[model samples]
Target: MPTVAQIEQALFQLAPKDLAFDWDNVGHLEGSPDQEVQRVLVALDVTENVVSEAEKLGCQLIVSHHPLMNVRWHQAEMQTLRPDRYLGRLLRRLVKADISVISMHTNLDIAPGGVNDALAEALRIEDPGPMPGDETGLCRVGRLRNPVKLSDFAGEVCKALHANGVRYAGDRPVEYIAVGGGACGDEIDAVIAAGCDTFVTSDLTYHQFLDAAPKGINLIDAGHFPTEDPVCAKIVAYLEKEFPQLIIIKSTSHKEVIQYFVEGE
Candidate 1:
């Protein structure tokens, strides 16, 4: 069994804490460093359900992409210090369950063979490279083996990501593509400079789609959960290799929360 500190060390080497953005929180957020961890669970977010799953599975640690203890402006007045508040309840439960937490956010996005690499793999992009003018490597530019229609490519994005729904703009061929998982819709300029014909990401504004359409760049909003969930499996595999003696589990309770409702279905 590896200690919590040892696992954090391995994760840091993979996505160094120094690489994280100034506003971002990464690495160990809670729990004792010296505690032993034999079973680890991985998830995209540290929701209450995910915490319950870890407790049920007897996991000693949870590796998630989003930090669990983030403070929002609206939540600031909720008395997070009290055990009854939303965040406070989760924190108390985690402490009582003895489950440690490690978050890899923007650091993982920019790290080589991290979130961007996993996204490229999920889309079956060939010879993916860092997006143009992106020194941090927050996005990837790549090409499909064979060119496909923009409509067909949108379908592929939905299928590949297992998305409940997807939105797209553009009517043209697609071969060269760029991707930035999890709310990176603003990188259209960089994607264009990379010579990509299409961009796949999430949280694209209506005007953003209109702006990119006439430029001949197809934009696909694949939903944030679908865009980033692929990295969770990669994290599991990486940790499994690092700690072969321990049991690693991806959270079963973690899934896309939003569902699309079509009329007359």
Candidate 2:
């Protein structure tokens, strides 16, 4: 049986801790490093439901993309675990259950076969490679098989990510495309510089859309969850291959936080 530290070492090979952002927490977030692990659960976020799912499935470790410990301070250490609050209650439950956790954020996004790569694959981008001027490899630039209308391209994005809806700017033809999973709208300029006429990412602001419209770069806000969730299954596959003896499961309780409901007929 593998230990938490041993699995962590394998994870590090895929998404190294040194590649993580300076402030971003990536690595063991909780539990004993030497604790033995028989099963592991992978999820996009470590929410209360994900924790419960792990416990129900008898998973000894929970590997997630977003860091549940990315707080300004160690709120989990606070004396009281308020039942009324989600964070406090979640922390208390994890401690009581003695479950281990690992979060790979920015490091996973930049790693090869990571978040951005998964997005590019889903979109059918050709010759996908790192975005120009993006030293961290956080953004990927590629070309479509043929040019398509902005609206049609957006629909393709929605289908690929299983998104409820997609918001975009610009109505021209799209060929070259760029993708940055999660909130990475800041790379719009780099996308343009890379000769990409369209950008696919999440958390695009009103001002960002306005700014990109004039530059002829169509921008699509595909929602953070859909943009990154594909990587969760990828993680499960990797872990399954790396540790065949251990049981690897993806959380059934996790789903998109945002939904698009049509108006009443």
Candidate 3:
């Protein structure tokens, strides 16, 4: 069995720590590094349910896209653990279960074959590359195999990402495309600068859609969880290959929490 530190090392290679934004947290955030791990669970977020699932599965470690603890929580002043709070409750559960946590946040988003790339592949974007003029490289620019109407492409995105529904703007045909998994709606300017006629991402504000429509760019807000969840499978596959002797599973109990409703349904 591999130690938690060993698995963390492998993950660091997959998404180097330096690639992570300075303000973002990544790598091993909880539990003993030297703890041996025979089974691991992967999930997009380390929620209460995910922690419970890890306990039930006998997983020694959980590898997640989002950090279990926020950057502010790492402060010495915030170190007082209170079980009443959400993060505090989850932390207590994890500590009791002896489940370690490793987060691959913005680094995973910027890494090759990571979140953005996985999303592009899901949408069938051809020849995906780093978004131009975006130093963070949190987004990917590419072209679809063929041009399609914005409405048609939105449908494809919803289906591809398993989104309950998608909110979109613009009526132009989509060909060149850009993708940013999670709350990357702010990158619309970079998407336009990259010459992408369509931008597929999540967590957009109404103002963003309003601003984008007149700019002749198609924007699809596919929901944050849907956009980033594809990378969980990628993580599972990578870890399985790296540690063939260990059991690595994507969390079956964790999933998109949001649902959509239509009138008279």
* Number of the predicted model whose lDDT against the real structure is largest: 3
Clashing pairs in 1: none
Compose the digit string of candidate 3's lDDT tens values, residues 25-67.
8999999999999999999999988988998899999999998
**Candidate 1, lDDT over the whole model:** 0.89
Model with the higher lDDT, candidate 2 or 3: 3
Worst 10 residues of 3 by lDDT: 71-80
Descending-lDDT candidate ranking: 3, 2, 1
Q: What is the Å distance of residue 209 in model 2 from its true position?
A: 1.5
Clashing pairs in model 2, backbone N/Cα/C closer than 3 A:
none
C-alpha local distance difference test of each model? 0.89, 0.89, 0.91
Q: After superposition, how far is residue 206 of candidate 3 from its true place, in Å?
A: 0.7
RMSD over all Cα atoms, model 3: 1.5
Q: Over the stretch 1-265, how does candidate 2's per-residue lDDT look in tens digits?
A: 9999999899999988888888888899889999899999999999989999999998899999998787544555455568777777887788789899988899999999999999999899999998888876799988998999999999999998999888999866999899999999888888888888899999989999988778878999999999999899899999999999999998889988787776782
TM-score of 1: 0.95
In candidate 3, which residue ranges exceed 4 Å CA deviation?
A: 72-79
Which regions in candidate 2 have their CA more than 4 angstroms from the true location? 72-84, 262-265
Top-TM-score structure, candidate number: 3
lDDT of 1 by residue, 1-265 (tens): 7999999999998998888878787899899999999999999999999999999999999999988765442258345556767777888899999999999998999888888889999999999988878766799988898999988988888999999989999877999889999989768887887788899999999899988778878899999999999999999999999999999999889999889997898
